[model samples]
Target: MILAALAALNVALAGPWPALAGSEDVVVEGAWARASVGTSRPGAAYMTLRNTGNEAVTLTGIMTPIAMMPEIHRSTTNDKGVSTMAPAGEITIAPGESVAMAPGGLHAMLMRLQEPMNEGESFPLTLTFSGGGKVIIEVPILKLGARGPEG
Candidate 1:
């Protein structure tokens, strides 16, 4: 009876366990967007995503009212020494880790923009987690030549 009581005490102290068993904690911070003026059909937005949840979260999609389509993208340097960008299917953020959407890395691609993205403007941005929860952020238009966060 004493052993059973001790076990019960331990379980209560630990509270309800995570549904996923052993999930780690991660968070997102310092999320912002970069402004762009381009003749192309699409423009890019940059930000940093920090994972502060108890489980790894995958960035599956984004919601933006300003653009027709918002997709995850990454920059890749080709053999010719030119940097090319493409769509990113998903991004995984480990517990206590972060994913940066900066220049020459992963970013958000806003396609079919209704209007030109100007500096000093704000837009609605919604990031969806794979598990279910979504984070809604207001992304301000940053300077076109501004550099993203370092580390």
Candidate 2:
């Protein structure tokens, strides 16, 4: 009886579990941001987004208090060897598809950083989806030049 009571209490305290990016239908993993130096105007955050649901979902927007503006961006190189970054509008993920955000590719551009994002620090980032699903996640700050999360 005591064990059962404890289990019930635990569930009650835990409340209803929300579906994060990488769980039931949508999964988000490997979320990390590049560390910023003094007075840096922008930073980048990378992550892998997976869609396990039956229907497609559009990643509508991102929000964070640490940056004045957060938007999806893509980096590309031209024939002249010049690289340019531009805003990427809504990104769609099909069923059983995974999208990777990495260096020189799609990334979350944090413009006008409110403060220096030092390494070893973590902050909250919210991702909004087209189906009214939102996921709040903590993004770890990695070294400025780190290539990926393993670094």
Candidate 3:
């Protein structure tokens, strides 16, 4: 009972983020998202993933309560400077390698958001890996179109 209460307190005070599973070999850093213009518009999240283990692992899925569907996506610009976003398949990280998700590049798409993602707010997201390892991260909502966590 005390442990449960402490856990609840931790979330309540720390943006409702779950503690990271220490056993997971993959580490997530600088997880954040942009504030949604409106509830009708989808939002995007970014982060950096580093593989600490000695083997390669594929990031297979993303799950979040704030959005009805979350997907992996990549953004590319044509020669004419028209950029398009498309679904990106699973991402693989080799041992001691790192992957970064940034705006106008690779990112996580939040479709059918439950509500507008406002600045100063945050949400939880779980990333699943091929070897059954999972990392639960809290993504803070930054200013609309913000580049990084500092903004």
Candidate 4:
């Protein structure tokens, strides 16, 4: 909800954020990752995927050079306010719709890191879709505790 509101305000106040060029109809924006303190812990990444095509697309797989295991996950808060995260498998986006991967929601989990992700550094993350083909976006590494991409 927070990321959606921020995006809406950005569009209303300024304009739509520029999308990362892709091979198909899905465009990505605001791709970022939090800097890792060391190689022991996994890192999380976030982005928004917009579908501009007429058909629905399912995001199937993810890959990045920084980690050995990159996967999609969804975080949810239960009725008791306990938060849990689980593997998301695949996500389908309808035509003209969008899926936002923000904090406390759907996001990418970069696990088994080969090296620590430092602030101000960036890496390419490849996402494969069932209908929309594939997209490789550059995800910037922000502060260790950043909740969202830097403005």
Candidate 5:
């Protein structure tokens, strides 16, 4: 009885299980999207991806039902103090490492939004990896001008 109680507690504390059994090498957390302004067709999503396995994984693609087109992007500022956003073809995460997608850096770009993403709403984002692994995560929409998910 004690063992059973401990097992239950472990599972409960672990939260939701991975999508695929024995495929919990990669985990995503703290996913969020910035609230959209009126008539804005593009938005960005941010998350932290961690790889706990002994192998590296490459994030290749992203898809979302709320957007007509989804792509990975990286924001950079040049020497002239000009900020530009460009497509990030792919991102790799080494074993036992974590990658953060935050503002002014790497993010998932949602183009041609089907509808305005309002605060307190959530949407699904499907991420595909190079090794045929895929994970569907629900990203929450935060207030406009929010810097991070903490808000």
Candidate 6:
């Protein structure tokens, strides 16, 4: 009876579980940018990252054609009830596990924007893994409210 109940509970929680990706694997899906029309000096991009490699890897740096510096950033809460985005030195993805970089969490902070980011446009992005492998991806800029399709 206990075992059966545990199985049922697992099934319920599994619905929201994250998918795993390989070590040499770098997948940038559901990439989107905020859609606040007109004024756009700086904007952020969000996506999900899965690393399925035998060895642990860290996301060390980023490169983009439009931005001067593309850095890894995470959102944190302070004691004053204020939220701030801080620069992350590196993000480690353990072997056989995955990392998700999405809105309200870890994300790529595109700073020193050279041009305005519009919806439905794709941009070139290069993510450097700690193990010396670089993944070049074409990230589609989408509206802020857009979300990845549920599997």
User: What is the Å distance of residue 141 in model 6 from its true position?
Assistant: 0.9
TM-score of each: 0.74, 0.82, 0.83, 0.82, 0.82, 0.72
Candidate 4 lDDT over 19-122, as tens digits, reads 33233888898999999999999999999999988877789989999999999999999999999999999898888999999989999999999889999999
lDDT of 3: 0.86
**Candidate 3 structure quality by residue, lDDT tens digits, 1-151:** 9999999996676554333322277889999998998879889999999988887778988999999999999999999999999999989888899999998899999999998999999999989876555678999999987989887
Task: Give me candidate 2's TM-score against the actual structure.
Answer: 0.82
Which runs in model 3 stand beyond 4 Å of their true positions? Answer: 1-23
Query: For model 5, what is the C-alpha lDDT against the true structure?
Result: 0.87
Model 5 lDDT per residue over 79-122, tens place: 99999999999888888999999999999999999889999999
RMSD in angstroms, candidate 3? 6.2
Candidate closest to the true structure, highest TM-score: 3
Model 2 lDDT per residue over 44-70, tens place: 999999898887777989999999899
TM-score of 1: 0.74
Looking at model 4, the pairs that clash are none
Q: Please list the residue runs of candidate 1 whose C-alpha ends up more than 4 Å from where it truly belongs after superposition.
A: 1-26, 38-40, 149-151
lDDT of every model, 2 decimals = 0.73, 0.86, 0.86, 0.87, 0.87, 0.70
The runs of at least 3 residues in candidate 4 whose Cα sits more than 4 Å from the true structure, single-residue gaps closed, are 1-23
How many steric clashes between backbone atoms does each model show?
10, 5, 0, 0, 0, 5
Query: Which pairs clash in model 6?
Result: 21-52, 22-52, 22-53, 23-52, 23-53
RMSD of every prediction: 10.4, 5.8, 6.2, 12.2, 7.7, 14.7
